[model samples]
Target chain A: MTPEELAEFRRRQKSRNWVLGGLLVFFAVLFYAITIVRMGD
Target chain B: MTTAAPITKQALPTDWRDFYALTKPRVMSLVIFTGLCGLLAAPGSINPVLGFTAILCIALGAGGAGALNQWLESDLDAGMKRTQKRPIPAGRMDPTNARDFGIALSVLSVCLMGIAIGWLAASILLVSILYYAIIYTMWLKPRTPQNIVIGGAAGAFPPMIGWVAVTGDITLMPVLLFAIIFMWTPPHFWALALFIKSDYAKVGIPMMPVVRGQASTRRQIMVYSVLLVPIAAAPWFIGGTGAIYGIISIALSLAFLALSVPVATRISEDGDAMKPEKRLFAFSILYLFALFAALVVDRVAAYQGFAL
Candidate 1:
C-alpha cells in the first residue's frame, strides 16, 4: 500500500478502537451502577 | 533514514462492518425481542440495569453463535447464492478471525451474565451458544432433513434464559414460551426452504424441501401449524397469561393455520409461483412477534390492576 493509504487505514482502525473502548467503559459503568443499587437495596 | 520499497496492497481487506455483519443482525433482533419479552413476562421485578445486561448478553450470545455458524459453513455458503457474499465466504475476512471472534464473544457474554445477573442465566446462555454452534451448526444442519426440528431448541433457549435471569428458577410458563418458539421454527424455516429448494440442493445441506420433496415438506408444515395452536394457547389455558394474550394467541394461530392450508394442499405445475410459501414465511415472523407482544401487554395490564 502507498504511505498515504497506510496512514488512512491506521487512522480508521484507531477510531474504531476508540469506539469499542468507549462501549466497554459504558458497560462497565452500567454494571457498577447495578451492583451499587443491589447493595443499597 | 534509508527508504524501503512501498508495500503492495493485499487482494482483499476486511473492515469493522464486515465483522459486524458476521453477527446476523436481523436474527439477533428477534432473539433480543423474545428474550426481553421473557424477562418482562416473569412474575417478579429485576433491576432495569441488570435486565438490560441480561438482554445484551442474549444478543451477544446469539451473535457469537451466528458467527461461528458462518465460519463453519463458509465453504457451504460459498456454494449457495444466498450466502455467497458473507464475510468468510466472500474472502473479505479470514475464517480463523471469524472463529476466534465468535469464541471470544461467547465467553465474554457468559461471564458477564454470570457476574451481572446469576450463574443460572449464564449457564443457560453458555448452553445456548454451544447448542447453536456445535449441536445445530456442526452436527445437525448438514446431516438430516429434521435438522431444523431438533436444532430449533437452541433458538428457543433465549426466552427461558431471560426468564431465569429474573426468577432464577425454571417454571412452566417459561417452558411454554420455549415450546412455542420451538414448534414455530419448523414451519417458519420450511416455508423459506420450499421457495429456495435449489439452494439447499446445490449445497447438499439436506433441508426439508430438498430431502423430502416439497409435497411432504408442505404437509409437515401444515401438521406443525395445526399442532402449534394448542401449544401457543397453553399459557393462557394454564392461567399464566390473561384473556388478552389468550384471545390474540387463538386469533393469530388460526391465521397461521389458514395461511398454511393453501401451501400444504396446492400442487405446483410448470412455471408455478411460490406466493403461498412467501406469505406464510412473512406471516410467521409477525405471528411470533404479535404473540409475544401480547404477553407483555397482558403482564403490564395485570400489574396495573386492570381486570385482565
Candidate 2:
C-alpha cells in the first residue's frame, strides 16, 4: 500500500481504539454505580 | 466537478463515523427520548444510575436494530436516493460486519438490562430487537403495504419497556403510552411515504403510497390521525395522568388533525412540492416529543403534589 493510504488506515485504527477504550472505561464506571445502588436497595 | 464513478468497499477505509452512521442516530434519539419519558412517568421510582442504564440499553438496542436493518436492505438502500449514502451502500463498511456488530450490540444490551434492571424488562428488550430486525425488516416491509402500521409496535415498545423497567410489570398507563405511538405511526410514516413514494416504488417496496396509491394513503393518514387523538387523550381520561397532559394532548392532536386535513384532502401533481405532507411529517415528530414531555411534566407535578 502507498504511504498515504497506510497513514489513513493507521489514523482510522487509532480513532477506533480510542472509542473502544472510552467505552470500556464508561462501562466499568457504570457497573460500579449499578452495584453500589443495588446494594443500597 | 467530481467524476461520477462507482464506489467499492475496498477503496474506502472504515471510520468510526461510518460505524456510527449505521446506528441511525437520529431515530435512536427519538427512541431514547420516549423510553426516558416512560421511565420518568411511571408510578414508582428507580435509582438514577439504574434509570440511566435502562435508557442506555434501550438506545443501544435501537441502534442494533437499525444496523441490522441496513445490513439486510443494503441493496434496496442502494436503489434509493435517500438511503444510498448509508455505510453499507456507500461502500464504507461490509454488510456482514454491520450484521455482526448489530448482533453484538443487541445481545450485550439485553444481557446488561437483565442483569442491572430485571429479566422482565430485558425480555421485552429482546422481543423489541427481534420485532424490528426480523418481523418488520425481513418479513413485513417487503411483503405488505401495512408494514409500518404493524411494525410501529416495535417502536412503541421502548416506552412500555421503560415503564416496566421501573414498575417491573405492565399496566394500563404504559399500555396507553404504547397505544398512542401505535396509532400515531400510520399517519406519521404515510406522510413521509406520500412524498417519497417514488423512491420506494423504484425499489419495489410496498409502501402505503406506492402500493395503495397516494390518494388512499392520504385518506388513511386522515383516518389514523382521527383515531390517534382519542388514544393520545386516553391516559388522562382513564385518570392515569393529570389535566395538563390531557389538555396538551388534545390541543396538539387537534393541530395534527388540522395539518392532516390539507395533506389528506389534496392530491399532488408532477413537480408538486408536497408542502402539506412535509409539514405534517415534521409536526408529527414534534407532536410525539411534546406529548411525551408533557407526560413527564404531569408526572413531576403529581410527585410534588401539584395536581394540574
TM-score of each: 0.94, 0.97
* Top-TM-score candidate index: 2
Worst 10 residues of 1 chain B by lDDT: B1-10
Model 1 misses residue B160 by how many Å?
A: 0.8
Which candidate has the top score in lDDT?
A: 2
> Residue-wise lDDT of candidate 2 within B47-79, one digit each (tens)?
999999999999999999999999999989988
Task: Indicate the fraction of true inter-chain contacts that candidate 2 also forms.
Answer: 0.73
Q: Please give me the total number of clashing residue pairs in predicted model 1.
A: 1
Model 1 over residues B166-285: C-alpha lDDT tens digits?
A: 999998999999999999999999999888888889978999887888889999999999999999999999999989899999999999999999999986665668999999999999
Model 2 regions more than 4 Å off = B1-13
Label model 2 with its docking quality class: medium
What is the lDDT, from 0 to 100, of the residue B276 in candidate 2?
Answer: 98
The whole-model lDDT of each prediction reads 0.90, 0.92
TM-score of chain B of 1: 0.96
- Looking at model 2 chain B, report the run of 10 residues with the lowest lDDT sum: B1-10
